[model samples]
Structures are given as structure tokens and as C-alpha cells.
Target: MKDRLASGVSIALLAALVAGTWWAADYAKRAVKEDPPRRLTHEIDSFVEQFVMVRSDEHGMPMTRMEGDRLEHYPDDDSSEVTQFRAVSQRTERPTMTATSQHARMDQDGARVVMRGDVQLRRLAGQGRPELDIRSEEVTLLPDEDVAYTDLPATVVNGTTRIQGRGMRYDNVSRELKVNEQTRVQIVPGSTRPAAPSARQPSKG
Candidate 1:
């Protein structure tokens, strides 16, 4: 009987040890699976997917339209940011202009936008107007004024005409482009249609 009692006690102790080990392992697993406490954070607004922004002219006409994959607004600076953004501008006398970039920033109710990372601007062809393209690393745009500018290296292309410069300003309203520094123009005289006869210098003696 004593031997049997000893055997029973040993079995009970073994069972308890096994249960305790299982409990310890379960506790450890739960501890590792639990998520850490979230930090306190606040923002005015944020958006993911299907983000659109529009800015209108003083006359209440739609001047610029912007769309993106992600948009975030910060009340602290009254500014907004966009990821994978594209924008379009409209004017009465000229073809619609569009821009695309990897990221963008805007303030003052999107009156102005600054875009970065492989920026490309294009003028849509319409009513015998030829298409134009501008490529740059960065650009600042005033859609209300129908203007865009960049201080970085820039390239402008239209048909077989190409312009390269360090800084550039383009006015969609007036169809004018001003290059600030290190400007070069290449035109295919026979193949490419002439675009800016008004900008040519007069013949000299």
C-alpha cells in the first residue's frame, strides 16, 4: 500500500508539473502575441485612396484639379500633402496643362502647389495647338495664375523642338516660357513645326 501511495503521489506531482509547464508556455505565447500600447496622436485629417482636390479661379471657374493615391492634411501648418499626385490646369485661351509627380505639397487652400520627384508637365493639344512637355525634379505651380516654375534643371520639348535650362518659368495664360540660366534650344527646322515665331530675334545687318 505504501508503495502504491508513493506511486500515486509521484503521478500527481508529475501531472502538476506538466500542467504548470503548459501554463508557462501559454503565458509566454500570449505575452509575445500581444501588441504594444499605441501612442497618442492627432491630426486634422488624412485620406488613403480616392483622394481629389480642386482649386477654382477668382471668378469661380474650375482652375486646377488634383488627385492622388494618398492625401494628408495638417491643421498645424494649414497645409496638405499628396503621394502619387497628378494635377490639371485650365485656361480660356490655351490648351489644358497637366502635371504629375510622386509627391506634392499645397497650402492656402491649394492656391499654390509644390511638386517633387520626377515631375512632368504637359500641354494637351487642341484646336491646332501642338503638345508640349516639361520634365524636372521639382516645380512650383500657381494654378490660379496659370503659371509654373522651377529652379532645378529642366527640359521642355514640343514636337522636334527641345529646350534645356537650369531654371524655367512657364505661363499658360500667355503661352510664354522664360529660362533663367544656362539655356539651350534645339529645333528640327525641317521636321518639327515652328512654335514660337514671336520669340525670334530680328535679322541683323
Candidate 2:
């Protein structure tokens, strides 16, 4: 009788130990498994191809035009993205300006535009100012404010002057251009390049 009781007690202890070990292993497995990844909210809700958007002034004059091969809008942030984008500005009394980029993002109201990848800006010659061109990797534009800026390396060409700098800023309305850091300026000695002849202009006699 004594031997049987001892054996039974030993078996009970071993069973408890096994059960405890299994429970611990199961708990560890549950803990090691990560929770399911949270879904991202940056999904595009709408998109357009060959998109064109124009903004006009109160006097019914077009101030700006934006075009893209594709435009995508996200409902989560009320922002829009564009691929192969180009923007043109013809604000009153200001030099006509154009911008092109591989990609761009605009705010909900189109007040701001951020361009990336091979960004280029061009300001047409007007009001005695020579034509200006700028190239950069990225640029930020505030259409309402008539301001554009970049913090990356940039190259500016104004008439015969070529400037290389680390950063740049320009105000369309004010016609002011600034370089954040002085890099180099190459001034080609020559008159401004002449405009192309008009297509309808008669050949010289």
C-alpha cells in the first residue's frame, strides 16, 4: 500500500510539471507572434490622367495653370500628388514663370506645391529683366505668395550669368532671387541671346 501511494504521488508531480512546461511554451509562442501590421492610411482615393488645373483671378484672368500625366488624391490627408507635372504662372504684372518636375505634391487648396526630382523653373524675360532659368533636385512653391525656394544644390542661369549654389530662393512678384550660399558665378561676356524670329516674319529682302 505504501509503495503504491508513493508511485501515485510521483506521477502526479510529473504530470503537473509537463502541463506547466506546455503552458509556458504556448504563452511564449503567443508573445513572439507580432500583431498584424496596421494598414496605412495613405491610399489614393481618386486619380486623373492628362490632368489640367487652372486658377484664375477675380477679374476672370487665368493666373496659373498646372498639368500632369497623372494626378492622385488622398482622402486621408486631403493632399494631391502628380507625376510628370508642369506648372505655369501668368500672374498679372509679373513675369511668366514655368516649372517642371518628375513628381509634385500639392496642398488641398493648391496654395503650396512641393516638387521633386529634376525640378526646373523658368522665368520669361519681361519688364527689362532677362530670362531666368533654375535647376534643382527639389523645390517648394507657394503660388499664392509668388515664392519658390530650394535647399538643395541649384544652378541658375540669368542672361549670360550662370550661378551655382547650394540653395536658392526667388519671389516672382518682387523679381528677387537669392542664393543661400555663394558657390560660383560664371559671367559670359556677351549680349543677351536674341529671341527666335517670329514664324510669320517675312524673310529679309
Candidate 3:
């Protein structure tokens, strides 16, 4: 009877150990399944710059010239010192965007870029004269659409024209600008004004 009781106790202990091991393994599996996947991060060791010149057949010649500087691209964080950026179209229309403290944070998939800081943008006329100047706090650049926009209040100056708005969108590809919310346009004095209409002729007697 003593030997039998000891054998029974040993079997019970073995069964408990097996059950505990199985429970631990199941818990680990559940934890692994519920945990979120990790995102990959790639750090940039040094600053880099890129300069690109774009040409198109529409002009039957070279169309645009672009230069950028002090760009640091990372997988998840923002780049630093994107100091200079300029684009010149075929008609000699040059548009430039720069920042004193520029940083671009890219999406994890690298589909979009968000630019922040003391952002200033300018558009030049065909004569290389400053036509437009824009200041904003934050801007986003969508490469797929070749567009840039900002939600912060902005001041835009184009030659004799000055405008202020709460938000703005610029189409880099189409060369169009749209301003939103409380837009005001002011034309500088001495700028060319529309000609006045002539008085009607007197009726014949």
C-alpha cells in the first residue's frame, strides 16, 4: 500500500509538470500573436544634398532646373538643414522654397514628406524678378502629385501684389497656387492699373 501510494504521488507530480509546461507555451504563443509588428528604422549618418534638372518635351527643350541642399533622409525621423531649394521653369519663372530651420519627416512608407520650420517660398517672374514670397510654419510635399501645402497662416507677396491667408496649396507640376481662408490681395501703388473705360458718345440731335 505504501509503494502504491508513492507511485500514485509521482504520477500526479509528473502530470502537473506537463500541464504547467503546456500552459506556459500557450501563453507565449498568445502574446506573440497579439503583439504589434515592429517598424524598421534607418538612420542617416551624414548630411547629403541632391540637385536635379528636369527636362520635358512640352518645351521642346529643357524645362526646369532644381537644386537642393543639406538634406538628411532617415527612415522615420525628419531630415535637417534643407536650406536651399529652387526650381526654374522654361519661361524663366523661378520658384524657390527655403527654411532657416528646415526638417522633413517622411512617412514610414516614404510616400510623403512633411516640412516644418521658418519656411519661406518665392516665385520669380520671367525677368528674374521676385514675383511671389510666402512664409509659413509648416508645409507638406506630396511627391506623387508634385504639390505642396500648408495649414498655417501665410503671407504671400508677388511683385506688387501682397496676399495673406490661413492656408495655401501650390502645384509644382502645374504652377498654380490656391489660398484659403481670409485671403486678401493688395496691389502696390504705381503698379499698372486697369485702364478706365471711355465715356459714351453723345446722341445725334
Judged by whole-model lDDT over C-alpha atoms, candidate 3 comes out at 0.57
**Tens-digit lDDT track of model 3 for 1-205:** 9999999999999999999999999998887866468675776656666734354445465544444565555544544334454444433333433322255554533335566677666554444444556678887765444566788897766566666878777765555666766467677789874221111321110
TM-score of 3: 0.49
Q: Any idea how many clashes model 3 has?
A: 2
List model 2 lDDT by residue over 151-179, tens digit each: 89988887777778787888887777777
Whole-model lDDT values for every prediction: 0.79, 0.84, 0.57
What count of clashes does model 1 give?
Answer: 0
lDDT of 1 by residue, 1-205 (tens): 9999999999999999999999999999987877778544547566557688777767887778889988888866778888898988876766799999999998888888899999999988777756878899999988778788998999877657787878878888777776666467788867855653222331100
Off by over 4 Å in 3: 1-101, 108-111, 127-130, 193-205
Candidate 1: residue 59 Cα off by (Å) = 5.3
Once fitted onto the true fold, the runs of candidate 1 whose alpha carbons sit more than 4 angstroms away are 1-45, 58-60, 192-205
How do these models rank on lDDT, best leading? 2, 1, 3
Indicate whether candidate 1 or candidate 3 has the larger lDDT: 1
